[model samples]
Target: MSKILDAFLNENLQNLRDQGLYNEIDAVEGANGPVITINGKQLINLSSNNYLGLATNEELKQVAKDAIDRYGVGAGAVRTINGTMDLHVKLEEKLAEFKGTEAAISYQSGFNCNMAAISAVMDKNDAILSDQLNHASIIDGCRLSKAKIIAYNHSDMEDLRAKAKEAKESGLYNKIMVITDGVFSMDGDIAKLPEIVEIAKEFDLITYVDDAHGSGVTGKGKGTVKHFGLEKEIDFQIGTLSKAIGVVGGYVAGKKNLIDWLKVRSRPFLFSTAVTPGDVAAITRALQMIMDSTELHDKLWENGDYLKAGLKKLGFNIGASETPITPCIIGDEKLTQTFSRRLVEEGVYAKAIVFPTVPKGTGRVRNMPIASHTKEMLDNALAIYEKVGKELGVI
Candidate 1:
């Protein structure tokens, strides 16, 4: 390696460590579920995106096994080049039905989904009005599009309206789109989609919503667009099969024309190999499960409310989360890291989230309570939180 590159890497590494901003990743010893094993120690897991605990569901596992036996391991090639299997077609059809859209298109992963979808539509001649706190994938996608990105304050409807009006009246761009996450993962707040739709209509801007975190947890498992009854109003609905769907892939559901265009124009779909048959089979089954009943969704909410109440009663600053995601706010970065470490030492696996993922000085330990987490598990985790909070002076 060059000396200059080595020096740059070393200096930045030291800086992050000194500031308590560097993340230390721990490997899970087994399947990521309500409980996890790290370094041979069992801990109640509150750090997963598995909101419905479907990742370990027996029925889905069996479905995936059967698919692998029938279709072999891989998709064999890219979608346009002979990788599009019968299972892939079926998954897309199921996605369209689930999202109540005319058609849908799947991608390798959620990150690639945004990277492909955003750049495929918008360009230097267009503009995108994005929320300040959208996921990093959306930010990168907007950048890749080469579109002029106008950011509005997080969920401030008036700010969005003002910006939309300004961008529209200026007429500097040929097309304009307003994009946001259906549920902001960091703060667990639902987007103001109703108000945003109203603004979009007033300005004649295209609407895009990435409901990665809201798919299995909101709107009776349909998602945030349905939560606000804007299914027909929104132009683009993007989602992940990885998180709530308990599989690995991403998709864009919309009118037939949008899907048709993406099939030809989206770079990821055109270039990348399709998802494996096993994952697709399992994803389709999981979507059906979510559509069939609200048992898992209801249980997830119950656990979320239970954990939030426990944290609040213990005097921890659990932020204003509308979904099953709970974030215990600890202002200082070092202290927040220490709080999380102490929790792990006491057998509760909640991870600290700091700068870059969130703003400086507003560090937190984000918790995800899922349906598979029993009352006993939550009570024990709460006890551990109390001990850690008192010891660390966080409460």
Candidate 2:
């Protein structure tokens, strides 16, 4: 390593320390569940994105174990060459059916899926209109595409329409695409896809929805596209298996041709090794669970409502979240960090999100409720919130 590079790293790290932003990683000793063991102590978990709680489901565990027994540990090669297995094909088919699409393609992760799909579609000749608060993967994908990325106000359809109109009238690019998260993970607000579709129709822009947060929580666990009943409207429907599906990988579901094109051209799929058989099997089982029963989904939402009510009752500014991702808004970054540490100390595991992840002044401790949490666990978590919030003057 270069001395200058080492010096830069040290300086940046020191700056983080000075600002009290350099946080130490905490280890979770046992399985990640509704309640977890961290630092050898059991705590009520409110900071996980495991919405359906299938991450620890017995059926998924069995499927994964069975696949491991059969296919062993790793996918030995990239998908373009010889890594395509029976499990891969079946998982893709199941995913396509789940999203109500003709075809689907998988990636190593949701982040990689964004990189693969966007850069494959839009390039130097095309421009992209991205929502102001879209996830970082989308932003990085846009930059890598070498496309002109014009950011529209978050969920502001009027602003998006105006930008789309201007981009179209200019005739500077062959195609214009608009991309947004189906649910803004930061605030849990649902995207106005109906209004978005109208603008896309008017402007003839290709529409993309990254529904990572909406896949297992909305549309009766189908996705945000189904949530809005826009099965045939949105061109690209992206989602992650990691969150609610309780597996690993990401996918793009769309018309047959779009998925076919991605399969051949997306760099990650072309170069990176495919997901292991165990992961593929687990996801397929998780999908079946979502389709066969709505029990977990119902439980997740109930817990969400319960937790949000509790937080609000304790006087925390839980933003306009329409879903389970609740934000206990603490104004200052340092205080937000402090609050998170205190919560962990109090045997709760909510995580703090500060500047650069969210807006500079809107740091918050985000709590995610899952189906696995019982009423008692939620009630206990609420009490911890009350104690921590009052002690920190955040209430």
Candidate 3:
């Protein structure tokens, strides 16, 4: 308890409180599915990234339990050591097959995958053209790479092309890489990967797409690259096993050479412990199921459409979302927070997102429609939204 440290923390925390920026975390009492219990209250969940509802699937849970029985609970060590178990290998193989790539490499988490893969390939002598709306992980990875990061307008091809041309013609860097999220999570807009691929070719830039939010939600569960039929064109395809796959890990799918390079050079893979055998097994099975049938994917999209249509009909400003993610915009930050609080009080579990996460004055309550959410649940949620929106003068 240093006095100086205490004063600093107290000051910043008070500042956050005054600004209505401090987020209070709510714990779910049970499994976080379509409906979740929090603080002894049951509510329809609209704040999860579990696009396909595989996170609580009985089959995936059973597979994980079976794996635990066979291989124990832990990975024992890092991947470069004794931790590269059979399950891990199989999961990587399945990921490669799922992404239509030659090979794939797994990491402990999606954040680690970005931090490891980006810095491993690009160095200080390189320049990274990043999407202005890319994920925090991508931004941190680019920073770690020591590369000059040039941000282009969100999904703006012209901006990207101009930056790429300038970076190339300047000859100030040895290699240039273009990195982006396949699906911009906040807005739920799909990236223009086809145009980006063409630009990459025109400027000889290494293309990297982090498809964490896209897997199992787009391209019939293949991803944005596959959705656009440019699987072979992108140099790096990064994804998470946690989001739609219903497990916990991340991976990079690409050519054999890229996989080999990551295996040898990625510091996180070399230092951090590998994902558990159970997680690896469950993720592999999830991928298999996604590839086997499009039932969950279709259901997810159906629910998304239903929710979006309902919100629009109710007259909420549900921004330009191209996917299952829906955002009910409330321009003022305080009103946005109040709107989310009202929704929770009325049995909806959507969270309010404000500045820093999004631009100032564009605060919103983001809703994620999952495959497990039933018609009744969506209808009830919509009823609640209508009530809250009208009460708050939002509709």
Candidate 1: which pairs clash? none
Deviating ranges (above 4 Å) for candidate 3: none
Per-prediction TM-score = 0.99, 0.98, 0.99
Model 1 lDDT per residue over 140-244, tens place: 999999999999999999999899889988989999999999999998999999999999999999999999999988999999999988889999999999998
The regions of model 2 sitting more than 4 angstroms off are: none
lDDT of 3 by residue, 160-202 (tens): 9999999999999999999999998998999999999999999
lDDT values, one for every candidate: 0.95, 0.92, 0.94
lDDT of 2: 0.92
Worst 10 residues of 3 by lDDT: 15-24
Candidate 3: pairs in clash = none
